[model samples]
Target: MKWSEICIHTTEEAIEPVTNILYEAGAGGVVIEDSQDLQQTFLSDEGSEYSLDPADYPIDGVNVKAYLPVNSFLGETVEEIKQSVNSLLLYDIDLGDGRLTFSEHNEEEWATAWKKYYKPVSVGEHFYIVPTWENFDPEDPNRKVIELDPGMAFGTGTHPTTVLCIEALETHMSKKAEVLDVGTGTGVLAIAAAKLGARKVHAVDLDQVAVQSAKINVKLNKVQDVVTVSRNNLSDNVKGQYAIVVANLLAELVIRLAEGGVADLLQKDGLLIASGIIRPKKEQVKEALIKSGLHVIEEMDSGDWIALVAEKAE
Candidate 1:
């Protein structure tokens, strides 16, 4: 089998939003690239580092690939796939007839390709990220370990959202506090909260795939007894309040939850840690928090992403 690489070149401002659109349209996955990355990886040898200009990087969009069946698709059929991706992309590429080619990998090989990116990382003093397949020897045995694997999930502790949440946990999480992790992709944040001494942790994701992935991750890390996994929408079967609620979702979803979901799930004076906010939408989320009666305690940034630590009004 084989695959085609569809490269979309758009103004630097439209990447993530465009990527989401493509994903909704049936993209198997996406690879985000800017001219700099493209130049380094394909055209030059500099390889991902150069004079930094924020605007030079694509901010508001993404490129996506629609995988076609390599077995049955002829070159002409492949061209149709290109057209499909290209139509959604709204960018120009010079693939002579706009036909790109790819070689398909067996499932094992494809999975292994992503496995190479997983490694152990320490997100905080007491919290460590260890991929399920990797061996992690913590420098201090007393430190807490959070096992994770990206397998079909979005986080393995490398993304800005994951890092920001770790920073939030380091700064404000309290011993014996109950934690609620909304959109707990791979359960990374919940595991971190558990390691930080949260007495109980409840994690939920709308994707059934994510729910299974998170459950496997929690068990892989030996935190199954402390971390509960559920396949429900954020507000679905969840009742009762928690001392700390962590939500790493799109800026819009974060704002909505800040006003409604978090407002109901958080105990008075409880803490809310939210990320997945782009720089442009930071103020929107801040305003939402205030509207929901949460007072901002602190805010931090990782690249263009922002995390806000807020407290429910006492």
Candidate 2:
């Protein structure tokens, strides 16, 4: 069967919402090519098999790709997808270099084209990301293995913001701590929390695509019992205070959550890890968090992005 290969060249920040848009329009799987990967080193051993081909990535931005079977509704589906993704600007999302394109491909090529860009790699200190298709083991037996079908999820553990969040979770999150993972893309953070010993995890995202992807990932990692995935905007309407809350969102949204009293969702002296803030906006996010009652404990950076680890007052 022939398929329409839809590709969107957009910013990294828009990945989740855009991928969600495609999923809502009947896309089965999505492939993300982050330009940042060109400069990233996934594992310490440079000789490892993991390498990204420049041809697969956009020159200046991220590319989100998906395949849909050609059908009578193909034109209408494409239009709908375009309109829905364009609508994200209403939410103040930066869709930088947002260019859309389509091409035709056979089922065989569509099935295997994305495999070259994905491979098992370690994230942070404890978590190792392995695609379900690869049969591989980490050199460290103690490294927590997270098996994910990346073709069906949001993140591949290559983003710096995500790594910074994972590292912070490893350092500050306590055993059996109930975790609230705000903006849980691909449910990686939620699963990380579970691996690090969080007893109960609530993974929330505003995008239905992420919610569904995260749910699948949570189960794939066998942390279904510990992490509950839901669709919600930040902390609005979320019940139950948590000992640890992690929000890996843009600076503005993080500030909005801070102003919205996201810290109130935390128990006394509990930690809040806020990331996805570019370096220039670091102070802006920090100020907002402090205004909303979180004390800045420490800050970590992964390239231009930053993660703020704060605590609610006891």
TM-score of each: 0.74, 0.86
Indicate the residue-level lDDT of 291 in model 2.
88
- Candidate 1 residue lDDT tens string, 1-314: 34443445453234434444434444454454333332221101221223334443454333323333344434665455445545643432121222233555444444354454345655656665667776556665666767776665555665656778888888888899999999898888888888778899999988776788898888887788889999877655689899999988877778768756577788878989988777877888899999888889898986666889999886
Judging by TM-score against the true structure, name the best candidate. 2
Please give me the total number of clashing residue pairs in predicted model 1. 12
* C-alpha lDDT (0 to 100) for residue 5 of candidate 2: 88
The CA lDDT at 230 in model 2 is 94
lDDT for each residue of candidate 2 in 1-314, tens digit (9 for 90 to 100)? 99898999998778877987898888856788888888765442332554566887888878999888899999999999989988999976788878999998988887887876777778878878877777775777789888777546567765788889999999998889999999887888889899999999999998776788888888889999899999999999998899999998888889999888887799999899998887878898888988898899999986678899999975
- List the candidate 2 regions with Cα displacement exceeding 4 Å: 42-49, 206-209
Question: How close to the true structure is residue 44 of candidate 1, measured as C-alpha lDDT?
Answer: 11
Q: Roughly what TM-score does model 2 have, to 2 decimal places?
A: 0.86
